[model samples]
Target: MKKPVAAVDPLRLLVAILLLLPLLALMGFGMLWLWQSGYLLYWLIAMVVCGVLGYGLQQLLVRQERQLLMNAATEPNPEWPPSADAVWQQVEALSATCNPEDWPLEDGRWIWDLGQKALETVAHCYHPEVDKPLYELTVPHTLLIIERASRELRRDIAEKIPFSNRLTVGDLFRIQRWKVKAEKAFNIYRAGSILINPVNALLSEAWRHLRERSFDQARNELHRWFLRAYVCKVGYYAIDLYSGRLALGDENYAESVTPESKADLEQTEQTAEATNEPLRILVLGRSNSGKSSLINALFRELKTVTDVLAGTTQALEPFVLSREGFTQALIFDSPGCDSPFFDSKQMLITAGSADLILWVSPANRPDRQAERQFLDALRSYQAARMDRRSAPLLVTVSFVDRLRPANEWHPPYDLTDTTNIKSANITAAVRAIAADLAVPAEQVIPVCLLEGKIYNVVDTLWSAILNHQDEALRIRLMRCLDAKKRAEDWVLLRRQMAGAGRFLRDLPEMLGKRSEH
Candidate 1:
């Protein structure tokens, strides 16, 4: 749609030279008059002093700008690997040692070379022993990084650079060619001046040298600025790739979805089913550990069946729990661990989907072999996944009232006060439970889930759940991302298969047409 810029305009060049010639002659005559009058030396000295002062000011401003650019270059992302700091430092070192004179000023090929070198530097930090770690990148992931970097660069140029959108590559090259011609013309004029007046020429040259030195310094600084920006951009995406934040087939999906339409995609996730699946909170315990009672207490109602007998919950029962000040979640009450018919496989599946676990332990029970073994196995299963975040575990020591001094039925027992025997025994039981389950003492909350006596449910237990809400949300996000990626893969696979079948069906007809032709 746009016209290309001409390489040269002889008429325009002639007009410019003609315009400059009169001024040049007037300046030459004026200098000759000053030399004869013996004022040229004083004028030249003043010019030299002004040029030095101007150059000094320019240097100061440039140093401040360079400091800001370098600071941004060295700043590391929080998710970057431990060795990223050293890699960034290497980038800074490379930038410092770079010489603008060695680089082709007009050609942009060096920009690509700089990016490639930065990629290698980042890759080496990830695998120092390997000769080339370029194989670490998958095609889709590599394309993702390129797309993200290019999009960001384009955005910056459009938003920050003045009139950059109007300039084409050819236009820039044309400007560069004209600049070279101007420099040559200026040098020729300087040589001619020297031949005409050697003393004046010598003084003028001294003043001109200061200006030329400033130009060279500015050029070199600009060169370093470009190098740092390009290298840091590459490193930023490199960190994203190495940290697993840059996912394959994710960018395309994200790009297609607008902010207002994001809910459509969110609805497609497994966690976003009918009623927008609430955060799953799996309740685990031994027989008669008051697991059902704890769930009922949390809901402030008789949400699940609670009995003193073992195997009260014969299967996993899920109830959507929505509290005023708590995260909306699905509380699954499972069969007691001591039940003979307990399904470990089903439990594992439910546990895998859980964002949080509420392990209820009875204060009177000391033998916890069954609970401990199941917990260890569950933890191992979670660790093997590696992709998903581990669900936070909260131990609720129920039946605290039945611990010590059974006659003493107290409310608001302060465990900090060691003199209170009941409180001390309850605290001891909590610590014991924490130790047995390999959980932190702070994570273990003591509660009395008796029919009439409900303690710590609102003040302590709910607060712990709220505190772990962020972690649970992270786990949920990872789970949903996996589900989304799986769906995307299947859809793509089906599309490919359909295309292959269509091509085979039309193959014979196309071959017949080709033979007739």
Candidate 2:
């Protein structure tokens, strides 16, 4: 256990007393010598200056203690984050008497690898039903719950700004500009007595800790108060919002809204006019490979129904995703490769029209021949005009939990961990898929959209996308959108040209005019 050190610790007091005694003795000796030399004025001045300096030192210590307390108050809360130790233990213990095909513990310790189990554990901590078991949970629904919870958590964190630190006039202006959102949340909370009730106990506990001089404890309590107040109370509306989005579905259609007032209608018109359209992301894959589930996961809402049955998607479905911080994007969940009604021409057109393409394949499926064929065809058709390499393809491999040695779901595995069979298999799987698709290994991401559990898709997928978001490519995509209603493969050349119809349009027309013999 560590000992607590306060600014006004007893040791400092003792040191001060010791130093003061020595200072007094030295002054007394100096005064006596001055008196003997008849220098009384000099002795008096020296005595007063030394006394003031000693007093200032004490004041400095007092000020430091106050600052320390303030800093502690602003610090983050203590959280006992949930883990998958028990889950992994069960898997490892069960596989203890296995052959080489087994789940292994780390360094012979009880520690397991950090993968799907660990990911779900962390997510479950913020879950509305915190103690829910992994097997019993519904993956997409639970993830949607977690997303709402986390978003509320962020909003609560934002509310502490004005109270968090001292602000200059300039700081206040910047905060006001940034705090439109914070103020809105604050207003909603203040507008009701009901919203503040849930956090009353937390506030009381925090106050008790503060008065008892337990600064750290107080900080922890206040953090709980904030999180609870926003996520639990103010966030009650989130349930309705999520449900509405789910029921309404991701189907975008033309609609007309007439405001009651002229000014309101004008404002609505202005807002719509100013709004930039979101980027279109088309998810491609084989049937039953979790395309709809991936889209719902991204939205954090069960907007689309998921099933193990193939041909679940019948048409090209488009959904708008407005995740905070990123640009609003349109994500389309398309019909799987194996759909009986699958039109190759339409699939080619849809894939080419997208601003981004997410090819979701199953990790367990050894033969990705179906998806590979579609991808190859899609590329070849586009290559008739522009460089096929211009398209940014991010392949997401799902069902990673089903990879061999069934129950093993630890993470932190890599192509480098030679000792671990799980790691070796995962790396091999990724490499094989990358080779089949003719894409780099980095472009292929393995995720365990673990059924009845949210796993590695969100962070790993988004991170890969952001990394590959080149400035030139983004500008080109934006230009394509502007020139045409949708960004298509044919328009890719327009992005590179100074003017539309300069290259292909002119050349194609000339060739047609000459005709064949």
Candidate 3:
């Protein structure tokens, strides 16, 4: 409980009365003497007037102080969202003190002192504790709960509170109480008692601000107090979400895939020892749609046979593609989806073993009905063998040069500005084909591949491929899908965002339930 400013010193009061007795006796003797001399009548009238005026002023001050105190005591706390602005400001002020120029050495250390005062202030109000000395409460006889709260907050936030954050309702409610305690601390600190401390003069200066109605000076101190307790209550969860654990590209996908990942790696090694490669990606599309060319481009060599025919490659052709910084991957150039020879079972066998699937289509083709059917069948087939997670599909619209005026060749196309004929054609084709295939617009990429020619192949295609490869690896680790499984980036992000949204939405309810418990 919050102790009083100081214990009552009865000995001092007794000494004061004893000392006043002689002065009182002398004044009585002088007054009696003056009355007998008949000269006290005028003085008595003046004394009575002065005494009545003093009593009236004292009563007025008392009434006003009591009203303000009652108003402050009865003020209901605001809800989380409504009070968020002040709480946010409070958090920022505390964060700013982390690097104070005037008191660099005392930056976060002062927070502990403030937190102690806050806890004691709250205890005094709600707990059945008798008034005691502040020195006793703050120093040698400090409560365990206040000490632990300060220590935990100091450790969790690294002693530097966060400035701006999406602090949940739970955090705000907890902080609201700390804020309450802090304000009470200020009220007590203003009493000018013998609660000796290093900050006594500073508290007096802060309390003096109320004369001018400048609450910031005192409220700022209270804000610092609230921040420490806020950190103790909600800081850990804040740091976790702020770190972006759910986002992709995090090494190990923000999780340690330890013992079980090793087992999966061993099994993968035994099964694919012949290739000894970590990943195998398949480039599949309609015949003559640049599937073979894309593979050869990835290899930077004419390793796969290419022909301008509807069914040039009637079988699967595998080649190795390696990059300086990336793991070596086996790239397979599969037959066109329209190739009459390959049935549904054959399609899965060709695609089932691959770690990733890259679907290529021509930007020049206006109708993708055939390609759409093939993709749908492939998705179902891949899903049946793999988990519901579709294999990471990176779709590339190759032959962008073949999009416009047949003769027009362009190295770069600004898809957004549709005035340029080639760019316009490319934009329209991508939009139409993407809409027709029911795939996200971002997945539909435009590229042109020719030996010794570079266009969108590097700028667009390779970037998307490398990105999808990482997700594919993460999924492999997740499902132990050595045989074949794919995870889409959109799917991963959507699920992550959904989970986050649910958490934020349910936070108030969770706090209510916990409070009941």
Candidate 4:
């Protein structure tokens, strides 16, 4: 039989040695002095004192060493021997035998297996608590292993599954559920790890490969493990963008108009005749879609710019334009419409109050997502107002000047002219999009808002709004606007009442008691 190696307690041995050495040296000195000077009593006292000191020192050293050992072993990274490698290999072997399809209904066993592997690795590397199992390990190491295994598993799933097949109802439902679980695991294992680091860069490269249908290269990139763990998150955003569910880029103005702003504009309109009623036009489009520049062009004022990107307008701003014959129009500049945060309910409320809806789309890059959303909103609003006359919905194709050849600095004809050839081309493009949305082709109008001469564009829009003969719609819109204004005032009154109540309650406290004290 092989002899068992003795387990050496480093802390106990260190303490014993530290306490023994000084006493031994003192005893030798006392013996030499006592023999030379016949100081037997002094030697006796010194021996007793050294005995007590040694005992106390031994206890202190032992306690200190115990603490030091415990701390070093439990720290985030502990050095371990080759046994850790063996444990990891064992985990990898177990994982290789397990198929996700054979797991529980929740499919959580795979994650559990990964967690176990991480714990096993940590266990082989560090000393466990006296009462705990030898295979159990620290939380951080377990998290690391779980994250690594999850990446591998997800990559495998992605490779084995085809994208087209993944779109089936059952597959999509399963994938969505799996994503939720995976996201939870990621948060637990590596929260805040997705913020534009080297990991994200590698993930982006992996995503490109995946996008190109190069699953092999994508898998290779994903094999990096840490980067692949963020794949589901990236995939979610990708689907949103490609499916027209999430609009890309930013918006130049507030996409939704506040009830208060709508009311104020509406009240200003009812004071005049139908033609004289301020054209409370709501300008909308995707981010960087030239909404602000169009408004500036319509008013013949440099109030807003073309270069402004999406989400630039945080609030609805009302601009009053004074026309000839003392007529005025209230044009509300709103935020970009195609925002992920956009609320269609609020938009309906805003647009419903408008005399005309000027739906804008950029001429250069017509975003399909914005176009779809705009059409949906228009159709929904029109349906809701079926009993009343429909508000005139004019499609303004903006930024025609930017669609020219690189060699040409500017277009030959004025962009605002409906009869101009370039304008005609723009009109046709808008008409095609409108036709697809089931909108009337005659409703589409083209305008280059960046150019100074856009009077014709403004004139055309004014003409359409004036031709609309819906007294019922006009009355309904006025009533809605009035109700919204009243609600706002009521809220303000409640706040004022609360403030007054607080003041009354504090009055007695503020008034000093009689001098009975």
Task: Highest TM-score: give the candidate number.
Answer: 1
Question: What C-alpha root-mean-square deviation, in Å, does candidate 2 show against the real structure?
Answer: 27.8
Cα RMSD of all models vs. native, in order, equals 8.2, 27.8, 19.6, 30.5
Q: Where does candidate 2 stray beyond 4 Å?
A: 1-274, 387-389, 471-517
- For model 1, name the residue pairs that clash: none
Tens digits of per-residue lDDT, candidate 4, 426-485, equal 556766667655667777666666565463465775566555525323533443434444
Task: Order the numbered candidates by lDDT, best leading.
Answer: 1, 3, 2, 4
Candidate 1 Cα deviation (angstroms), residue 102: 9.9
The deviation in Å at residue 478 for candidate 3 is 3.0
What's the best-to-worst order under TM-score? 1, 3, 2, 4
**lDDT top scorer:** 1
lDDT (tens digit, per residue) of candidate 3 on 116-213: 44433333332335574233332312433344444555464443334423555477677877988766544544332323332333433543544334
Write model 1 residue lDDT over 1-517, tens digit each, in one string.
Answer: 8998887677876776676666667777888898899998888878778877887987886677667545544356543334455766776665565566666657678867776777777778777888988677777766776677667666655654457799998998999889899897787577666765676678778778877787777667766666566666777777666654455654333223222223433443423333443577999999899999898998889978777777878977777677786656667788988897689877887788778999999999999999999999898987776445578899999888987799898689989989999999998998899999998999999998988899989889999999998888666655554555666678878998999999999999999999999
Segments in model 3 whose C-alpha atoms lie over 4 Å from true places = 1-277, 349-353, 381-388, 479-517
Distance (Å) between predicted and true CA of 290, model 1?
Answer: 2.6
Supply candidate 4's per-residue lDDT for 235: 27
- As for TM-score, the candidate ahead, 2 or 3, is 3
List TM-score per model, in order. 0.64, 0.40, 0.42, 0.37
- Give the distance in Å from residue 361's predicted Cα in candidate 4 to where it truly belongs: 0.9
Which of 2 and 4 is ahead in lDDT? 2
Prediction 2 TM-score vs. true: 0.40
